[model samples]
Target: MSTTFPLLTATAVLPALGAVATAAVPAARREAAKWLALLVSLGTLVLAAVVLIRFDPGGARYQLTESHAWIADFGVRYELGADGIGVAMIALTALLVPFVIAAGWNDADADIEDSDAAKQRRWRPTQGFFALILMVEAMVLISFAATDVFLFYIFFEAMLIPMYFLIGGFGDRAHSGGEEDGAKQRSYAAVKFLLYNLAGGLVMLAAVIGLYVVTADQLGEGTFSLQQITEARAAGELTMGTNIERLLFLGFFLAFAIKAPLWPLHTWLPNAMGESTAPVAVLITAVVDKVGTFAMLRFCLGLFPEASAWATPVVITLALVSIIYGALLAVGQRDIKRLIAYASISHFGFIVLGVFAMTSQGQTGATLYMVFHGLSTAVLMLVAGFLISRRGSRLIADYGGVQKVAPVLAGTFLVGGLATLSLPGLAPFISEFLVLVGTFSRYPVAGIVATAGIVLAALYVLLLYQRTMTGPVEKPEIAGMPDLRARELAVVAPLIALLILLGVFPKPLTEIVNPAVEHTLSDVQKTDPEPEVEAAK
Candidate 1:
């Protein structure tokens, strides 16, 4: 069952309009911006929930679509739709924004000692901060809902502007002592992130153009519609030759790998997340990063199945390397924010591995991992932000025996950490387990190597927890720190509850995701290789 309601367009537009509305308010009333942004985000969440309820999991195609000619001459249509995976991603984006706003409510007024120059450039967390966040939400929603390749690219690049400002503008200079040095470091991280992504985008643009040219040659006119391209490929009516197809695939894959921040290309993420505020970090690492893996499944494989299959060996190797390398680095980090960033790189490896595995279980697990990662990471970052706000530092060394003073805060942090490490009763555990089960069924060697990540995950999370939350109250400043406040609890409680709920009862999410995975695998026209067993074993 499909229907036309313009819900997707509404979800994409409301946040931008809200951003404008928040910006229009007077500076004296800047506090009102947070409330307004919250309302808008909540409304968007409701719309996304409606979409989820209305979505037919059994349907193998985009639903509740809004398609109309945008640039008729170029065959570019303003198309918006969501399949099960897209719906889940959209819902995750919507569900997280309101909490981000809430988590950052007092960020503007939070007192921190900094050099004069640092104070001058520091983000005030005023109306503009909230506005930029809302703008990002709008673009993100559009990017996930977009069915036209050009439309997706436009929204995809458009998301960077707000996120750039969110990192550079709103970030604290606590990592460095000198105002000049800290500001410079923040600027450098933001720029590195932008340059890396922009380079990838340019490469993808060339591929997009190549695809259009090939489509025109084959079908007599150019098209940037994903569905059309996919159908043409399936029907064997669009053949760009194996070489061109692989080239096009690489173009798209390169952009996604960078965004996915796969292995070596992931250098930008740690710095960016370290320099950015917690809420912004959550937005980037959790919500925005999912776009990379999602596009891998949607565009890379959907349009270039043969190339994807051919490249699986290389992709799986990178995924395994990411799993090990990211975990090792995470264990070595002193800064909590950067530690979480490395942890994310490790988790993203699992997501990518599942995507490239090309089995029904693998795709479903990857998609679910996207949602679980966002929620769990949000809890970790937000709770850590609470600790930073009280301690006026983000370094783990600065903290000791925080639990004695702030037991609730410590408990929340532990929950977040456990979820991050994929504790047996947490949401991430389910997704991670499925990813391994699926991968082992096909690529047993890679799957076995990747399991080491699970052990590494426990080490890093527990190490961080033990270093900061346990031991004697050595720091006088930390001894009197207050526990989690009402507002802080309000922000984190739902995330914790959902993690537990989904961990135990994941059937609702899995039912929605399974069909979508089946659909994606069907598009690729591949099945998992049968596992071999020894005769007497």
Candidate 2:
């Protein structure tokens, strides 16, 4: 087989391939459609594992590199590769896709009826759902792999379409909330998400144009490629004064912060999460949300070092407020899922805090936190889905005494909850500790406040567990509810295993991430010398 079609590049395209195959399947064979979708997801997962095994953790640049000139006039290329961070995220996306598919298996009934013909029609839309999800998987993979800034932006914006449909059409409340109610909620969320992102995109577009202009003015040539830009900036050939860098910083920061859905700009998350299905939520939170954090590391900090240094204090403050605000809101929520969704806001704040701290340990901790958060959150949401499926409610007050009937489920809830709380020996603890340690070295006050988020996390996670799993088995309806099934266990066991494994052996992952991080930080150091930069010209 040609190396060009190596596992990494092919992984992104496979889902699009699956979408095509799924579209071709006759509407009459809905069962076959489901099976085919499952197979495609599994294939991608296996391919991702292969990519991970083949990955060189020691490399400081993207490994398994693939590039092809694709919009030559605009300096765009079909570039793909992974450093340790990208590979870990790719693995996380691949790992979560199968579980997302499995979650959809017994959950797609809202679209089908009792009749065989009705089921066939149900199969059609359900297949469409699977196909859309696969497309999403492909987009996320490409977004992560794209080495050209222009290419990255294309994949970055393309993700919104599939996700908007996923939340709007496949949602449990899509219809019951009334045509106007559900439609309005989804539409509002979709439009808000799109507009906020587009606004950021516009700013970044200006920045990118400015970058190309600067490069051509200084080096006698223009290129929109990431490597080209990095090299030019590193060589002191691309120059932006302090004021210009600050504007560009805000442009990139707006896009990431909106996506990060940081404090004050985080209005879109609750509604979106409330309207989306569990699997859709997993995809949105675990995979799509990381893009915001990833872009900050890749673009803003990579390109605007002086601006990044200037804005660190302000961004760290917002991050702290997000942590506090999210935790407070989580405590007041009646909807269990929404509460977990808000909890993510708080956790993301911690990640941002670490990243902006700009210490090697801080960025590495932020990266690990990203991966661990994805794993723990996927399992938590799956378990929540299982409960909602049995009880037919997401309201915390509606649940009581579940522990007596579903001991296994209660235990699963315990594991997921404790993991979320970052209890010792859990994966999050290692990262959270590193984040605090690293951040404290720079801004002790911000680090101290961010540390308070951990306490709130424990309270909210434990409170959720107590209300849902440990109450007396009084309700006749809930008392007869079934425990976790084989399929549910199949979907979640890997996450639990990984949480434990990473908690114990984080060094292997961290060792890989630190080298690339050092290289990135070196770029920042080079840009710190504004006088020398001006002198070079």
Residue 228, model 2: Cα distance from true site in angstroms: 1.6
Tens-digit per-residue lDDT, 1-537, candidate 2: 115556777888888899789767787676787788889988999888887787776654778888788987765677776777787788888889988998878565566677867754635776788888899999998887777777788888788888877877777552335757777777776677677777777777887777777667777776667767777788877877889889888977888887877888887777777667788888888889898888888878878888998998899999999999999899888888889889989988988988888887788888898889998888898888888878777789888788889888888878888888888898988888988887887777998898888888888988888888876887777978999899888888888999999998888788778877777677678311122234555
Error of 1 at 31 (Å): 1.6
Give TM-scores for every candidate, taking all chains together and pairing residue i with residue i: 0.96, 0.93
**lDDT (Cα, 0-100) at 402 in candidate 2:** 87
TM-score of 1: 0.96
Instruction: Name the lDDT value of residue 418 in candidate 1.
Output: 98
Model 1 accuracy (lDDT, Cα): 0.89
Backbone clashes in candidate 2 total 3
How accurate locally, in lDDT, is each candidate? Answer: 0.89, 0.81
Give stretches of model 2 more than 4 Å off: 1-5, 116-123, 174-184, 526-537
State which candidate has the highest lDDT. Answer: 1
Candidate 1's displacement at residue 247, Å, is: 0.5
Candidate 1, superposed: residue stretches over 4 Å from native: 110-125, 531-537
